[model samples]
Target: MRKMKLPESFLFEAGPRAVLLLHAYTGSANDVRLLGRELQRHNYTVYAPQFRGHASERFEDILDEGSPDKWFADVVEATRFLKEKGYEEIAVMGLSMGGIMATRALEVGDYIGGGSFNSPIHHIGKTRLPETFISLYRSFNKRMGVPDARIQDSIPRIKTKRTQQLEEIAEFSKKVAEDLNQINVPYYIASSGNDELIDPANGQILKEALMPYTEVTYHEFPELTHVITVGPNRESFETTVIAFLNKLNWKEG
Candidate 1:
């Protein structure tokens, strides 16, 4: 039997209050599907949209079509899509790069409030993401039967482009940091102490930056890796999310 291809985006509608979930760098909407289902079970509608150029087998698609600007536009569009569905009480969150996108949206988009799970907000100076993207590219091509030698031959060019793309994220993070005063709303942030891709210190960097102007709920999970949504202590993390959502007055009259 042929394997069925999973969708790039997913939605779970359960209630009037909605949450938009974002995926990680080089990952599809699937990254947040599990957490979205959990949120849905708790009666919050969940929608996870695939970033532009993501879920594509071609690495060039991501390099050429994906960037902070384009993905942030995608984030805004996803929230609009939710609003059109009649969910007026909307919140947005994301994993990693998805979290960065969520932060940008919270700055200027329509949201009651939102946060990120292991997102690189203030600390984008140097990231492991470029290498992660390149590794994924190589491994994906290898899975498609590309020769290892050929895959290696393409690594240098991919790395250069991927590094340049990462610079876009760093630039965006800098912008968010500079304009932190614009985000005068509730926001959630979580960090994995064991995270390897981004410095865990980013949680502190973000809180210190946002706390002066916003009501920030911050957590650092010592044992969890970069993806805290599906970590071992996910139950507790989910509970924290529930608590945050419950505190929000995100309802229409």
Candidate 2:
């Protein structure tokens, strides 16, 4: 519902191929910068936008505006913007909650040549979060000690009123996965075997759902927990990602 001004400093590479990097909840464009840099090294124009209805504004605020439908619209608009700029071949990638949004976007958006998703939230089922999760999140937030107005809410959880919407979102995502298979494009997906935030079973669901997409590559880092794929295993993950892009023949457009 609102736009976070993209930093002019985020230089999109001089390439015909474009990649949109989406970040997770409470995350900003900066969070995806490393991934963008890597993609840019391959001559890809990168556009990583801030999603709508963020926890910074208020945890509950995201509930009102960050619906899957709105996010899908946002991604389409972003893709079209890139297309107008002469970047024809496009790919979209997202992590954590953003991954969930990407699927919905891919289902309805156009001009997507391929994509990658790391730690995607394919399903937001009944809240099964443990108390430890809440504690750890709060502790980390406190320790980080950074002031982010948009994400100043209490410990995050699935907003109660949004349960119906989440269920619908899951269904929409499932359909998106099916549609992804029909498209003749290469996809790279990475998941952590020990993602405490999302059930590992969800990873299985994603793998199974995307199985029909014949040109798919999946990697699971068993030792990587939740967001650790971008942390401890950063280099390895980046290597896999570069390989995936190379395989797709998505070099600098």
Candidate 3:
């Protein structure tokens, strides 16, 4: 199996307290590269795993191999890798879809805290309609024997396979939302008021869901966009994450 020509998984050893950083859907480790470096600078071991089927130069390849289960498995495997490396006190943080997977990771890993940035706990906008249309178009194209590359070039944003993947993810997000109480660990949730992809209200929904079971800190970056981990407000995002980790009060092993 050939891997995408992109940055590999990053690991920086510094302390017993380790932090696992998960990237967003259709995104690779490079998306969280800055945050990983920042965590390492604070003397914490950091590992940012590249999600399966991501980092590919072609979007079609990603759509072909990507799935919600594969994303979840990637996080589980990353946590296990961290534990095997002697990281006892572990924390998880993710951006967007990564945030959804990070929460799921807590169910199977011994994590002290988790952070979510611009993650959607529910679907918004046209939702499945566009995907359905894309699926119909794809079927027609297939019946007509259109070349894959031509089909890809004609409709780059939506594909039947990718639409199905998104639907799977939406279902998973609903499950995570319903089981929010299972997240007993201290969690950090951040959203951008200006985010065009995920509605910022989902942050409040998560905070409300977890209020009865654990500590939840919600922050609204009014000026930022969907990609809060990178771009102009990245410094503030990293600072908030480090502050959250510092306040976790986990004993250094």
Candidate 4:
């Protein structure tokens, strides 16, 4: 079968300093499109890469291929692409699951600083049945070749996969938490106090984890949800990001 074409990623070129924006799990480049545009207006080159299995014809594809490793690969590729283009100073920002990737990128990529929004450093609620069922359903899908199953027929599977993916993400987040001290770059961490998906305490968890090694700026918005980037106070979110970037002092030669 011919692979489905993913949605267009965003790249805006203007200056030697660059910013790589990463979207949430199961989300497309569109999640961070507005932020990318804002950075571009500041004359900062920006790139938002679409993750594998995301933005495809079916959400099932995300279940089959969207692992943390694959998402991190997207981050790695975007950062290297910017470096190859001669951007001497680069920063990475991630939202939700992308936050984990951005945090991990600081350890592997040559970035000056990074930021994360509404990310869970430690997952809440302990449930294993969902992931168990998701594994079974995925196997059933592969055995039956039911890639185009209807919503009613696949809703349980979809929910299971989403839960399972979060479990996987939590595992990775725990690993990142353990090694947070190795990430010696300045970081901006924020979360909503009433985030419906992740516990608001995660923001403090991340901030505290990084405090021993690097500069950490933490913020809490009591009114916003997990998806703060596109919330009612989205302008405020954008302003916060712009301010963080402006403070980097990466002057082009």
Q: How large an RMSD does model 3 have?
A: 5.2
Mind giving the per-residue lDDT tens digits that candidate 3 earns over 1-253?
2333566889988888899998877567887888888889999899998888776544455567777888898888888898888787899989988999998876556799987898887654423334544655565556556687877777865554666777788899888787777777899998888886667787787778788988888888889888788877678878888999999978854
State which candidate has the highest lDDT.
1
- The order of the candidates by TM-score, greatest first, is 1, 3, 4, 2
Taking the tens digit of each residue's C-alpha lDDT, what string does model 1 give over 200-240? 88888888889889899998788888877767678877888
Which model is ahead, 2 or 4, in terms of TM-score? 4
lDDT, model 1: 0.84
- 2 or 4, greater by lDDT: 4
- The digit string of per-residue lDDT tens for model 2 on 42-131 reads 776788776676535243445566777776676777777777877777777777666766655555555444444444445534333344
TM-score of each: 0.94, 0.74, 0.85, 0.84
Backbone atom clashes (below 3 Å) for every candidate: 0, 5, 0, 0
The top-ranked prediction according to TM-score is: 1
In model 2, what lDDT does residue 36 have? 78
Q: Which residue runs of candidate 3 sit more than 4 Å off their true CA positions?
A: 1-5, 124-158
RMSD of each: 2.1, 5.4, 5.2, 5.0
Candidate 4, 1-253: lDDT as tens digits: 3455556898998877799988887567888887888788888889998888877655577779878888888788888888888887899989888888999998767788998998776664433434544554555445445555543477675886677776787788888887787887789987887677667887887787788899887888888877787776778778888888888758669
Residue 211 lDDT in candidate 1: 88
Runs in model 1 with CA error above 4 Å? 1-7, 124-126
| Residue pairs with backbone atoms closer than 3 Å in model 3 (clashes) | none
